[model samples]
Target chain A: MLEAIINILSWLLLLAGGAFGIIGGIGLLRFPDFYSRMHAAGLTETLCAICIIFGLVLQAGISLLTLKLLLILLFLLFTAPTATHAVARAAMIDEVEPVLSEDSPRLVDYEDRP
Target chain B: MRDTIFLIVLLALLWLAISGIYKPAILLLGLASLVLVTWVVIRMKIIGEEHNPTVFAWRLPRFWLWALREIVISNIHVARLVFRPEQISPRIVYQNVHFQRPLGKVIYGNTCTLTPGTVTVQLTKSGTVIHALDAKSADSLAELERRVHWLEGETDEVAAKDAGEERR
Candidate 1:
């Protein structure tokens, strides 16, 4: 019964991840600007990858493959945020302006204070 | 001379194996081709440490792991955008490439393209042109580059060595 429960849960997670990935792909294709599309892709990478890998782990039933999968999970955790940060910094260094909503906080005023 | 024959033999073997038909005569032919290609590759010295097959052995596992972590964090960020709507600051930007080799440039460009919100609009000897989905994604790409550099064993020493080689 416990194994069955775990199996079902992992499957659900995998499905959720797959859905998010597709949504992200769609967002990347449909979004108006590069920034929005990136947000979509980045999100998908985290959610989808985790879910699928989780499901795979459950199915693999504890082996070398599972270890490798976990290693992959750890590696992604470290790299993704750093990569995202770099891309944004690069954009800013290039003087790309964010598309701000009307009520967004102003960074320019903060910059002027110094 | 040996390398050329080896390559041809290898290709022929690969073709046979991939064909997937169970024929005794075909199997023999495939084995023969494999031997021929190995001979060629060995003679030509086409396979070396620089072009070693084993070098990229870890890339797939590493890539998968990287993808997983990216998904979770980005999910949270996206959720914040959806609910709180404060974190997202979308933008498009372009940046220059610093890598010298075509392979490095292509790998860097393609990797960004694989990730969310970044696309390779153009690549030139001068630099790469990227269309980032947002400011965050753009920043991510830059970070990814640093990580890639680290993975490639790029260091100050390596850069200095390259410079020295170029001066000669």
Candidate 2:
């Protein structure tokens, strides 16, 4: 009974994670600009990856495989943000201005204000 | 001296965990590689206070929990924005972070990027330029910066000084 419950839970997590991955991909294609697409790609990707890995960990139980899976999750969590930051910095260096709405052109330049 | 031992033990443990082999020859090979790596690390003189800043170690797990919560919250926020693209009013804003250490600044920048709606596009000595999806997201960047400062164990006086400078 317990094994069946665990299996069901893991399947649910995996399906949910797959759904999020598809949504992220659609968002990436539909978003208007680079920065916005990055938001879809980076953040959702991290969550999706975490969910899938967590599901795998549940299936693996307390074993060396679970340890390796956890390590993979940890590495992903750390590197994804760093890679995203690097891409964002590169975009900024290339002078890619975000496409803002007309009414809310409130770019707070706190550095220049002082 | 302490750092060297810590590195050696860590590497040895990692080797054992990864190999999972009990044969004498493989164990000898692992030990030899470990010794070689440790010797190279020592020769490079890289293990020091800067590399291993244990001062903030005690606070890091708590800070990570807070950060994870923030990430989840922002992930939902951004997910909503992705679904309703019209709601996104993306803009670039700057926030002056007063983290005295480069490690703190890097952490702040990475955390900002990790959170969904805002990305740290440029981290200069003066401040961080963040590309945020909306005004609310940009405003939250300041809060995130403050949390990072707290994680670094910075005092309120320094934070107040930075805030005062921004007011000018």
Top candidate by DockQ = 2
Q: Which clashing pairs does model 2 show?
A: none
Candidate 1: regions farther than 4 A off: A1-9, A25-30, A33-57, A60-114, B1-51, B56-64, B75-90, B156-168
The 10-residue segment with the lowest total lDDT in model 2 chain A: A105-114
Q: What is the DockQ of the complex in model 1?
A: 0.15
- lDDT, candidate 2, B28-141, per-residue tens: 999899989988988888875444546578677867877778876877777777788888888777677778788788889888887778887778788887778877778787
Model 2 clash count equals 0
lDDT of each: 0.59, 0.78
- Candidate 2 regions exceeding 4 Å error are A1-5, A102-114, B1-5, B32-55, B155-168
Q: Give the Å shift of residue B69 in candidate 2.
A: 1.8
Candidate 1 achieves a global lDDT of 0.59
Worst 10 residues of 1 chain B by lDDT: B47-56
